[model samples]
Target: MVRLIAFDLEGTLVKSVSGWVELHKKFGTWEKGKEYAEAFFSGEIDYATWARLDASLWKGHTKDEILEWVNSVEYMDGAQELIEFLKKNGFKIAILSSGLMCLAKRVSEELGVDYVYANELIFDKAGRITGEVNPVVDFQGKGAILRKLKDELKPELSVAVGDGYNDISMFKEADVAIAINPHEGVEGDHNVESLYEVKEIIEELTRGQ
Candidate 1:
């Protein structure tokens, strides 16, 4: 029976405009930026260099400006209802994201979820973008945290839901993996196009309803 449900923040529960992507679209081709970005995220380059390049994309934007831009992000359809259902059913809900903590905290408070695991963006006292993320969590690192949570909770079963390549990494540690209308590929253990559909999967997975 599934007992805990973990979700990815961006492109899963809530989706916000990509600050760096927006900059690239305004100044140049997004593909050009993504080519280098993919490599950086894949570990071909150091995180510091990646931060420098990512920051350069924004040029002179203030950290608050960026946060405000993201604050307007919209949650996926049925996201609120799904969270409510999980909570009502006595399941542990966690937001597992690779997003900035500032934005993550905002979303967490809005959704009133239990726990949040994400990265932190560094800003100067002036609240200007410093172009650095503290302890960026991506790739296989997510699985490590989920595994630890599973051990601690000792739940009958653990589940993870998301729609990005990075999210698929948690499959090994989760009892069930759900891919929700993935923006890139359909390689998750199970795939769906709607949050309501995901709720059904969870309902069926849970042992006594």
Candidate 2:
């Protein structure tokens, strides 16, 4: 009796493995971005500090320029179909990612998602990157966020689908955890190679409910 589905954005619904990394690569800041990512993963820096460091790389870029980059991101195969299938089956959909809000917001709007939570890069009055950030989702905080969402939404059961290490937290919070093309060692109640397979899994889960 699943009432909701939470999905990771990059590498789950979207083709990019990480929207932040892709943006950094596009802006020629990947070298520094990679270092910051390593530092964060190694426990040398907190998420806020890491996010600030990454945001600073795009300080002078205009919002429109960043939006252009965001627009370039493509959806994963069967993303649209999977979302539509979930919606049609009367399940609330949520996008929970540690990626940037620029891309997450677009995906939510385009797919008509019910909820979304992701980090945000602040902008100045002239719409330029401000070297600041609103770190709404921490790489290791998905479980806490999901628990909060569960309390607020009160879904009888919830499913989480993702592919990265960060998603492991969400998987723990969800009633049904699905690892979609997961990274090494990331396990879930079920493992799938594609979003199409996710549809079949959901269909089976919802058969009697």
Candidate 3:
């Protein structure tokens, strides 16, 4: 029996604009921007420089503008039904994301999930985005957070469902990891594309005594 059902936010549950894409669109894709940010996540660049570069990306945009962009995001089809069914089955649901907390919070509210954990976007006094989250959970750090949750909850069975490498971390601790492929170039163990199929998989996986 799966007692806990955890999910990834962006790319997994919804198709929101990615921070990298948004920043690149605004800042003209400075190779340094992508390279250094990648390096910082990979531990090549220190935290301070990463913060400075990230802040520069949204230097002019106000918080309201960012929220507007997020409001336009589209959800994975059948995402709502899947969450409701799981809840009816007595499973505790949580969203674990490597994306921005601002967007994750919106997804959580839309889906009515029990909890959400994601990197926060810092703001300046003028309410402009100051920088990306410090210690962001992009790759391996995602798995670390999952492991921590597993230890804390110790659910009878923990299942993770997601659509990207960031979701791969769920495998570190979850009893089962259902990978959904909603975008090209992303690979998963299950490779499901629809939320209805995901609901069926969960039902099948939990069937029988």
Clashing pairs in 1: none
Model with the higher TM-score, candidate 2 or 3: 2
User: Candidate 2 on 7-48: residue-level lDDT in tens?
Assistant: 999889988787788889889999999999899989999999
Q: Candidate 3 residues 112-132, lDDT tens each?
A: 888788767777888887664
Looking at model 1, which ten-residue stretch has the lowest summed lDDT? 17-26
On the 0 to 100 scale, the lDDT of residue 102 in model 2 is: 91
lDDT of 1 at 158: 84
Q: Against the correct fold, how does model 1 do in TM-score?
A: 0.84
Of 1 and 2, the candidate ahead on lDDT is: 2
Error of 3 at 90 (Å): 1.6
TM-score of 3: 0.83
The 10 consecutive residues of candidate 2 with the worst lDDT sum are 1-10
Score every model by TM-score.
0.84, 0.96, 0.83
Prediction 3 global C-alpha lDDT: 0.73
Clashing pairs in 2: none
Best by lDDT: 2
Error of 1 at 104 (Å): 1.8
Q: What is the C-alpha lDDT of each candidate?
A: 0.74, 0.91, 0.73
Weakest 10 consecutive residues of candidate 3 by summed lDDT:
131-140
CA displacement after TM-score superposition, residue 15 of candidate 1 (Å):
3.1
